[model samples]
Target: MSVVDPGSTRGRIVAAGIELLGTEGARALTHRRVDERAGLPQGSTSNHFRSRAALLGGVIDGLVAGELREAEAVHPATAEELVEQLAALVELLTGPMRVTTAARHVLFLEAAHDPALRDRLSRDRRAYVASVVAVLEQLDAADPPAAAEALMALCEGIILHRVARHDETDPRPAIAVAVRGALSAPGDG
Candidate 1:
């Protein structure tokens, strides 16, 4: 079970933090702001998080937990299914999940300067990669791990472009190509 339940105070604070980060950037993520955003009493956020690093850590944990939950729902039985799933993921990230995606990008920049944050994010990323690798293995990819990495990179790029650059171009073609390439024989490509 996840430590941060969506209905709990801690989860509310974390969700507020993500919203703040997504809408107003990292500078606006203060305990007072989080408390206000969460519609809690003053000091509530500080009471739970204790420090800026702890608050950020809570946000990261919350994001990872939610992402893992979504990933757990994906189980592609074939290469084409993988492509469709990945394409839909891109659409979801760039659409309804846009705010969360923006918050993630903010954390990514912050992680560059914080080794602890970077480590935490890296650990979560490895978990996601492992899940993708499992799907690739099921589809009989030539090199599941490498292919998973490639697909992850490609999806990251697509998400970044769509979110940051506001590029509305379709991602299905690229996702299909990458999925097909990953499933191809090692020497056939």
Candidate 2:
């Protein structure tokens, strides 16, 4: 849960790693490349992260910390407000935070083949879902955990479509429908 100081050398290295992954893909995520991207002296990244696995772990940590910070800024009082916030979040992810989002997607693909990375992602994902479940409970959802999972899946799908397909469609309407559905009881449909 500790935040990495962006001004610190470690932070710079992690940021550089994200940028490299997003722009140049996984193959370019070498220590030398990260050092060059961060404008640090050669071997600086290696000094901080002894291996590529360690470096990837650091990047995942940095990404989760930053995304959690952003998510914390959004406080929704009701289901409707949550819909708006979620839509805004989608825009933010695919717009201003595009590179970071892309970097996350890259890590997600990498995690599919790496057990340690997948475990890290799953842990973070559970923490994030728990926070959403708390919000849903406060909003009077019949099944807060399930509702939160659905909402998260909806947002992730929208973000993936927008980011991977270059789709410019407005995501609000779909978000509204999903949010309302999640908040509704089984027989209320």
Candidate 3:
């Protein structure tokens, strides 16, 4: 029999974990389920990721990478232009990106209980904040780091609100309001 590469098995397991995170949320994420979804032996998932937290860490990293890629798609030439970019990001969060962000929340809550997990979460979050700051800086926004931190908080808050209410109200207006507040001139600060 031809030997299947271990790397392929690892990829499949990670893919399965991502799908589970999106569809069933964190509770349904497990080695057995990931193994079954990936059509691999039950042991394969454990072999690749020794612990549940390890697997979750991988999923979080993947999700962050995906978000960074999506964020990159919205470019702004000026602080005013960044408002539109921020709106675009909010729309993306309120729509297709909802699963990723929502699932990330679940993972984040889980991380809170585990110091190792919390460290991973904090590092990934800082990276994301830095990416946002870089984008805002490119648009000549004053206090890009602070602006990015505020924007991330706004996005998370909007996601929580939308998820809890399940209401049809779009989050764009609220996000725009927050962004405008963040991007207000230094004199206003």
Tens digits of per-residue lDDT, candidate 2, 126-168, equal: 8789888888888889999999888899899999999999898
Per-model lDDT: 0.90, 0.89, 0.74
Local distance difference test, candidate 1: 0.90
Off by over 4 Å in 2: none
lDDT of 3 at 95: 77
- TM-score of each prediction: 0.97, 0.97, 0.83
Please state the error at residue 21 of candidate 1 in Å. 0.9
lDDT of 3 at 186: 84
- Superposed by TM-score, candidate 1 places the C-alpha of residue 113 at a distance from the truth, in angstroms, of 1.2
Candidate 3 pairs with clashing backbones: none
Q: For model 1, how does the per-residue alpha-carbon lDDT over 1-189 read when each residue is reduced to its tens digit?
A: 246887899999999999999889999999999999999999999999999999998988888887777776679887778888888888987899898889999999998998998898998899999999998888898899999999999999999999999999999899999998999997887
Give lDDT: candidate 2, residue 86. Answer: 85
